[model samples]
Target: MLESVLKTIYVIWYRELIRFFREKSQWAGMIMQPTLYLTFVGTGIASAMTFRQAPGGTPVDYMTFIYPGIIGMSVLFTSMFSGISIIWDREFGFLKEILVAPVPRWAISVGKALGIGTIVSFQGTILLILSPFAGLSLTLWTALKVLPICALVGFAIGLLGISIAGRMESMQGFQLISNFLTMPMFFLSGAMFPLHSAPQWLQVLMVIDPLTYGVDALRNAIYAGIPEAQAILQHSIAYDLSIVGLFSIVTAATGVTAFNRQG
Candidate 1:
């Protein structure tokens, strides 16, 4: 079982790496988006805002507070866009080749999801690398630990994306599904602000948003010890991870099931 899992992981991971490196512009975008958002969006928002007191009397300057949001948004979109690639694979017959592999169908589904997760985690590394510049008080140890959690969350999102992509019979149809999933999840996820401060409608919308759980989990990780966001995340970590875990299991089950279905 262990060897099978390892082999499955390696095959998908290698294919993902090849795909990522094959396009220079894609890699550049992955590294660029977070940097620009931190330098501009995060800082610009912090500069004009006067934060009220919260847990631990944490002072949220725009950049520091927005850093985690940027990371969260980056991971969310990166993993979700991975579905577009899966669509591309289908168009090019690559997905059929994968489907015909000798491995169990679940292995293939997990492999692809894990591959997407790896890429999304790479994006997180790029974002967090700019942490100090955005006045984020991050440590190497914390950042290292953040990697696995980010990857896991990304994996879960990838599985969800895979299931959605599987039902899309055409590239045009897949585009609509991608837009539908990505935009709503991003906007309603409290990525721009916390749920308590949001309007009642947005708060209710967040009740069904997986991205909210992911953002909360990530915030808890980096801010676990920091004075500002730490209190907010520390209070919320348990609940966030629980939700994230649930998302992972549910999406993975659905994705693997879809992979096993007859075409």
Candidate 2:
């Protein structure tokens, strides 16, 4: 039984990967938004204001400060949108075929999440290649540490998308609901700005956003070697990971439950 479950997951994961690679447009679309934001938006903001990771610690460039945020933004968008694949499967009757297979429903959900999460992590890594251009001092060690965090962020958000897609009947509805959730999550996640100086009400919202912890964690990992690391980090790496892990667990359970209930 265990072997069967593992095989089922691998099959689903492989299928998703194949589908993603076959659609070359997915590559362009996934990478374009983050690239544009990092270059144009990041440049514009950097010109207007100087940013420091911490008050009087070190004068960090605006581009450096926002680099991790751009990575988080990429992972969040890619992972969340990847859930629409479920709707597409359903529309084409592929999902029905999978449902009828003699495999655990939870495995299906997990497999889909993992498949898309891998894609999201890949997208995030692509952004890491641009770190130097963003004024960040990238090291091999830093990139390695950042990779796992990206995978965790991707898995958590991918599960969220899966949970929502499981309950959605149409691609239109899924896209609408996803856009509504993604925009707010990105803006409030401290992705574009520092949360330390945010208004009280905004801080509360940021605290509740799972992506906030993800971004903070990425920032902590990416800047771990900097002298101002402690001052710049919103929370310790352990705390940030704990929050993201908890979120992943909750969303995994939720996604499995949704898949189990699907008819």
Candidate 3:
């Protein structure tokens, strides 16, 4: 059972990877916003905001302190709604081919999730590659350690996107989904601001927003100078992995069930 699942996942993952690179616009689109956001919007804004201590007591410049949140931002935005391609597939009939595949239903959804997740993670990796010049740094062990967490979140986002795309009947509906769910989720997350600094209700809202957990956990990982003995590292590691993993399973299962039900 496990082996079949693994093989199915592998096939889907490889196919997704190939399709991801073959499209020029997709690659360009994935990296474009992160590059511009980090280089222009983020830096441009940070030039005005004063540096302050993070949730931890560590003192640092604003850009450095906030860069991981931006990385999480890039990943969350790029990865989650990536199922927009399903919209095109719906129009042109490619989605039918996928839907009619002989493979198990979950395998199909899992494949799509992994494909989009991996593709989006690459964009985050590119940001990581350029991070040092942008004033971020971390140990080899720490960097490698944080990746699975990020990938899990990416996978969940992609799966949820697919589930939404599979369920919706129109682009207008998807646009409403984007506006109602995606944008609000991003705003509520600490991607651009600290949750503690917000009013009590906003803080309460942030708890339900998975992106907030994602950003806080990633911020703990990618940005350096963590105290060696601190539980923040442990808590961050635990929450990020747990939340992403939960999201992936739930969304993947939901997407698979919803699509296969239509069959």
Q: Give the TM-score of candidate 3.
A: 0.87
Global CA lDDT computed for model 3: 0.71
TM-score ranking from best to worst?
Answer: 2, 1, 3
Give one digit per residue, the lDDT tens place, for model 3 in 1-263.
Answer: 77776787788779778877898997787778778877786788778866452546555555664567677777777676677777777788977786676566677778778887777667767777777756656677656745765677788887888788878778878768866777878888777777656799998998788877777677767654645213223245576668767767787777776476554
Stretches > 4 Å off in candidate 2? none
Please give the lDDT score at residue 171 for candidate 2.
87
Least well predicted 10-residue stretch by lDDT in candidate 1: 226-235
Give the per-residue Cα lDDT of candidate 2 at 82. 90
RMSD of each: 2.3, 1.4, 2.8
* Model number with the top TM-score: 2
Q: Which portions of model 3 show Cα errors greater than 4 Å?
A: 1-8, 53-58, 224-234
What tens-digit string does per-residue lDDT give for candidate 2 at 1-263? Answer: 99999999998889989999899999999888999999999999888776654556667777877889999999999999999999898889898999999998999988888898778777877888888898777888888888888888888889889999989998899999999999999999988988887889999999999999999999998888777545667898899999999999999988876678767
TM-score of each: 0.89, 0.96, 0.87
